[model samples]
Target: MIDAEEKIVQMADLEIDPAQIAAYIALLAEEIEASVDKEPGVLMLHAVSVKGSPAKIRILEVYAGRAAYEAHLKTPHFLKYKLATANMVKSLDLVALDPIAMCSK
Candidate 1:
């Protein structure tokens, strides 16, 4: 059965150089999407950028619960992405969110 309980999630806002935006987007579109789908308890994974500010990327990830979210950080793809983009990213802001309500019925 699907878990309907509230979940804690992490949102990451990343700012990159304009020149590297295209490459970052292409890399994520080709690799990250499929990789994240394989993770357990990952309810949703999304990546978006601000209009006209291609260098700004925001990722919203929701997990089944705290354990699931923690597990995701240990995944290979997450580590790889962190390493690969370390130099490309100019700034990163991460926030933890507490979900109060969710309607998926």
Candidate 2:
């Protein structure tokens, strides 16, 4: 059974520098993989680019709870990703979500 009320969901909207999109994605992949593989609280970290706008990125993040999401921010891989992609990111927006219902396989 899952405690839906305890889950923390967020969406990240990002714009990467056109020339640095490849490099930004590489770092993001490393961070997402490490986060999901090593962190028990990380439920999901899915990223995608707009169909026609390769530089526009969106990430859907789901954590077990607030603490889990906070812990994720302190992870080494995340820190490294932030540092490495700082210059590659042109803009970033993070939005919190309150899921009315949740379902997954």
Candidate 3:
């Protein structure tokens, strides 16, 4: 069971180059899969795009805590994704959150 108050949740808002959206999505998928499969601290990683703007992406990330999030940043898969997508990304905004309630079945 996860303690909602102890979790570190955040939203990653990114603007990917229109021409590179496909490539960016591929990398993002791979990274999310690897993180959840390999790290117990990684609670969730869900990525979605706006209704009509495919280049505008948002990722909802949930980690066990600050240390878990920090550890994720140093993982090989995350590092690879960051380096590979550096040129494809136009802008990125990271928003931290304090959850009042969180649940999943």
Candidate 4:
């Protein structure tokens, strides 16, 4: 478990147009992969589509700290993603979270 006070977790709730789901997912997956590969401070980034609802999307993003997240915003891949998907995203909600506890095997 990480120290909750130091960890930065963000929940991204996205609503996409049905016609843009495939393209949005492709872009999202690519960004996630690139973030994890290129940024050591990016702890986790997992995206999922809601079952039976093709336009609804959810993502759980974890970073080492606030500074890490700040840096993530300035990365080339992230900038590219933000610019590329500007029109494809119908709605977006980003929620900052305090990690109570987390585990992975």
Who wins the TM-score comparison?
A: 3
Candidate 2 is scored at a TM of 0.95
**Which ten residues in a row are the worst by lDDT in model 3?**
96-105
Cα deviation of 11 in candidate 4 (Å)?
Answer: 0.4
Which is superior by TM-score, 3 or 4? 3
Top-lDDT candidate index? 3
Any runs in candidate 4 off by more than 4 Å, and if so which?
none
List, residue by residue over 1-105, the lDDT tens digit for candidate 4.
546688789899999988888888899999999999999889999898899997889999999888999999999999999998899889999998877768787
Q: What is the C-alpha lDDT of each candidate?
A: 0.76, 0.93, 0.95, 0.90
Counted clashes in each candidate structure: 0, 0, 0, 0
**Tens digits of lDDT, candidate 2, 9-97:** 99999999999988889899999999999999999999999999999999999999999999999999999999999999999999999
- The per-residue C-alpha lDDT of model 1 at residue 22 equals 79
RMSD of 4: 1.4
Residue-level lDDT for 53 in candidate 4: 94
Give the clash count for model 4.
0
| 1-105: candidate 3 lDDT, tens digit per residue | 767888999999999999999999999999999999999999999999999999999999999998999999999999999999999999999999887767688
Give candidate 2's total backbone clashes. 0
Candidate 4's error at 29, in angstroms?
Answer: 0.8
Error of 3 at 34 (Å): 0.1
Which ten-residue region of model 2 has the weakest summed lDDT? 96-105
